[model samples]
Target: MADVKSKASVLLVGGGSVGAIAALNLETGKQAAVTIVCRSNFNAVSQNGYNIKSCDHGKINNWKPTKVLNAIPKASEGSTFDYIVCVTKNVPDVPPSLSDLIRPAVVPGKTVIVLIQNGLNIEKPLIAAYPQNIVLSGVSLIGANEPSPGHIDQDFPDTLFIGAFANPNLSPQTQKAAAEDFVSRYSAGGKTQCSLDTRVDWTRWRKLVYNSCLNSICAITDLDTGRIRLADDAVAHLVRPAMLEIVAAAKAAGHELPATVVDDMIEMDPLDMYLPPSMLSDTRKGNFIEYENILGEPLREGEKLGVPMPTLRVLYYLCQAIQWKNKELRGLVSIPPKGNYVT
Candidate 1:
């Protein structure tokens, strides 16, 4: 049986930008007991704590978790949390996948696996691992970066879209319960948490529309979003075409991604031109990029569905080359960066 406590227990597994921002927001009203797994940066985080500068959740100079661990701690041996958020990057090639990271804190069939990372069709592995566990996801539009240890910069849209995974085997009531529980803990401030389209699956596909363009374009060319499009007619010849391929692929896979997304992304101001994307930043900094989960999986899906994504295929191959170079340069096999999107 589940303990019906008013206060929830949340175990955040990554101390990256999204992880810090999530910790700051979810712990409002101290509604939930938040424990952060800092991994390698545990020493820095334990002493300094999180230094957050946000456009939404205004400057929290020192936001410390109830507990921090260098790895999945034994403290979770007999304990289970209401929410287990994996803000860590979803690199399937990596060992101890997300499924393994949440093991210690999980209560078997009861805990909710909240994946706050980027990627499409990412919830499948968790859904397969914990068939009964309610899996929820969030697409964070906010721009967040880790400039240094225990420090995070959260700039941009003060909103995040979250809801239950699109799965027929799951019960809507159960999913909503999990969503509402998170909302209850997350709605302390003016932060916007939207549940659009009555289904959360579309949100992931929608973000891909922009990410596929900007993330790849910026990473390959080593330029910001605006600069990439502004150079050598890149927007017309490269970015726009790749985005169109994604739109077509999504449609063929039975997901409707609006065609207007291309124009909307192109026209984004400030706002749009500056700040390189997470993937782009990671590549430039020689950090491990989420090539497989973010780009590879989506392209494979398009191929499986018979959707011809020649542009996306090319983009994937390019990103993969960079990924290989980074790995070879660093002598690494499988491990996400300490901060998921930290560059």
Candidate 2:
């Protein structure tokens, strides 16, 4: 096994909330070199730096980067990175949009691609594309979002679990070393805990179960997590049935998740909790939600495996309808007036 270094040159795709937090955390490691690429073309981030506002860490402003590019430029041509972290949404069709952005920064055999997105379906396509590159699956527990163009808001502090997907050639020693290096960088940098996992299947499914319950409900209702957590029996009546369908789906997928994870999906009162889900935030910002990736795909998988998921199937279709309605409303609101209203 090769000795992993304390620092690594990283190319981070997706400068959304999670990406920003990763960038801030990377700053604590003196040896680490980091660059951020986003669709927003945040050239100002490279100039004035990032301002991260967090409830746990107060205000962190002017967190500069080694480099920041609005888009991955040709100037970065032929440059290979030690690590490539994909923090974008897990829409299977969207990988092509990122292929051009990622191709230049990747160096076969040495670069490790860490996917820190929602859903279990990302592994297959990423592995198929970069067969020679190391592919690792990761789940982020933190909640973050951008309120404006350059500002990041951290809703909660959470841990990161990372492990290999299907690379049998990845030695246990090498995996542990790589995981340790990541944990050290984040822990030393004052970010949340980073842990190595041999069995990430449970971790990934646990998160999926959580999202399957929370994300679509929040999006359809236009409510934050607090509201859902504090919802009364009427809401529970609606939610629990759907959750059970997800459990059935998971079973069909060959993952035996504990029933307790679903039974206790919302354990706290919303009045006491202050967190909002990414899906709800996405709806608010008029951005595309990973609806298909998170809800639709699992439902399809369940059907393929002959699992009954009536509630999930219904919820998925309902969420899609709601999204379409929301989009139509936004379009109507954005239209310019041919003449001023006389009212």
Candidate 3:
């Protein structure tokens, strides 16, 4: 890591609720100049800035970024960012790749790319795309949502576990410094705390304990995580079984995730009963959900390792069906009424 600078030039992509929280974290007394690239609310955010309300940080209205754009600028064609934190959905092979979007901002040894996304093997493409740049993976445990344009509601105690993506070439000490430095910059007194977790693979697989079950299950059953777990027979018949299958797959993949992972997920406070997971939110909005990375990849890996994930396979197929329907709607494909439909 470059001599731990006081001020880091950060480029944050994906201006969703997670992105907004991250931007707020970087901006509140941190010495980083945060620039956001918003895909949907570019005009609103550009004209009026971002407005956020958080249980941790309180109300911060019209908090503007250094710059906002729909895409990376042409002028930044050769510029460099000290850090590029992406708080976007992990839908690889869907939109642009990370390197493609942030090509100009990364300065090999100087830049660190932080991916705060869900699921296993999310960093593979970014690592493959920019083999020289440092890549970090993070999993955030919190409920946040963008209810309206430029308005975000953040739940309390956002704990982000960050770790360096395993690179044989990079020494452990170097990875530690980079990861800890980010923790230092992002961890406010108590708002959205960040920690350096050395176990990247463990974090990813363990988080799947909640994600593989809560995210898809919630979306599938039209219930929140709590509701799904609290229902009379939901946990026994569906949630626990699916999570056990995931744990088996993780073990087969050489990461021994404890069954307590499932327990912890099941025990998550039922107070936030209506908070929808991103997958469910996307489904509700008729937007594409991340099926491959979150579900398919692990299933494929399990199959390769001779472990069958029939439950995950079925749920994955369900999510894929949702994805297909969403893709068609998002692509502006119109379906006529049953009487007028062309056979």
Candidate 4:
């Protein structure tokens, strides 16, 4: 494997909050030749650059990358990338389709794609699109949001865990080395830590359990993390049952995720942490909620695996209905007679 530091090209799809933060961090560390592709027009980002404000790091203004493309356009005809980082939401009903943009960058044995979104089911579509490309899954505990175009606000700086998909033929040493290099590069000027865990699937499932319990519920109730943390009754009454369903779904999917993961999740007090979830921010801004990828996917998979996930099913449907209702009230879109939970 080539040294990550020696690499000259990197493509970052989805210039949302997380993507912008990652790009700024990567640029600060001088990691590879970085290019950020955004759905918004180039003139907008080019004029103002990116403003990244973090609780840990003071506001950064005009943090620009090597290149910013409005969209992924055939990879510049012959351009290739060493690493492709995808930080887009996987809500199927959302605009700016991420999978279609990323498909052009997945060349096997040449490009490695790292998914840093808040979902558990991005792998299926990614693999179907580029089976031979080295696909890695990861979970970020960091809290981030976009206050405006070309601006990202990171509330909580947290750890990142990354590893290749389960495969007997994967080279562990190569994966570890790559992960370490990525961490070192991104964390050079920051305090974040990235670890290489072979148990990538378990880690992802653990995060899924967390998201399943927190994101949508907070969005639906319009509660902040601090409120949820202080409310133990809410955890036991609502969160725990949903977590149980998520655990059952993970187990049925052949991943043995421990129940203690949920306990650890609830142990995070939002007041002490002083961070809000992206779902809450999305709801406040009237953006689409990523209900399907986090909650709906698990519920669907659970049914297929013969696992009972009633709590998750109900929560998923409720979130969809709520989002649909919001859209209808706002006159954003006409709600379909049969509500679809794709987003």
Which digits, one per residue and each the tens of the lDDT, describe model 4 over residues 70-187?
7664654876887888887677765546567676655665577788877777777766666555667768877777767877778777567777764334476665666666666666
TM-scores for the candidates:
0.89, 0.83, 0.90, 0.83
Candidate 3's TM-score reads 0.90
lDDT of 1 by residue, 242-261 (tens): 88887877888788877688
Clashing pairs in 4: none
Top model by lDDT, which number? 3
lDDT of each: 0.77, 0.70, 0.78, 0.73
Evaluate residue 306 in candidate 2 and report its C-alpha lDDT on the 0 to 100 scale.
89
lDDT by residue for model 3 (1-343), tens = 3234577778898888888888888777465778898988788888888788888789888888676778864434665677899887777746666667776666766679999888777777777777766788888886788888888888755789998998666787787788888887887434666888878778788878778877888888888766775678988978888888888988988899765788887776463555677788887776777778888888788878988778888998998877777767666356755785577
Off by over 4 Å in 1: 1-5, 167-169, 194-197, 269-273, 332-343
Candidate 1 vs 4: which has more lDDT:
1
Q: Using alpha carbons, what is the TM-score of model 1? A: 0.89
Tell me the tens digit of each residue's lDDT in model 2 across 1-343: 1134456878888887788887777766554678888667376576667788975467988776677877653424665677788887654433354444577776666777788888767677656667666777788888677777668888767578877776655565675566656556555555566677767766776776767767788777877667776677625676677777777777777777786876566652244565567777777777667777788877888788888878788778886766666666756335556787786
Clashes of 1: 1
Q: Each candidate's root-mean-square deviation in Å?
A: 6.1, 4.5, 3.0, 5.0
Q: What lDDT does model 1 reach?
A: 0.77
Ranking by TM-score: 3, 1, 2, 4
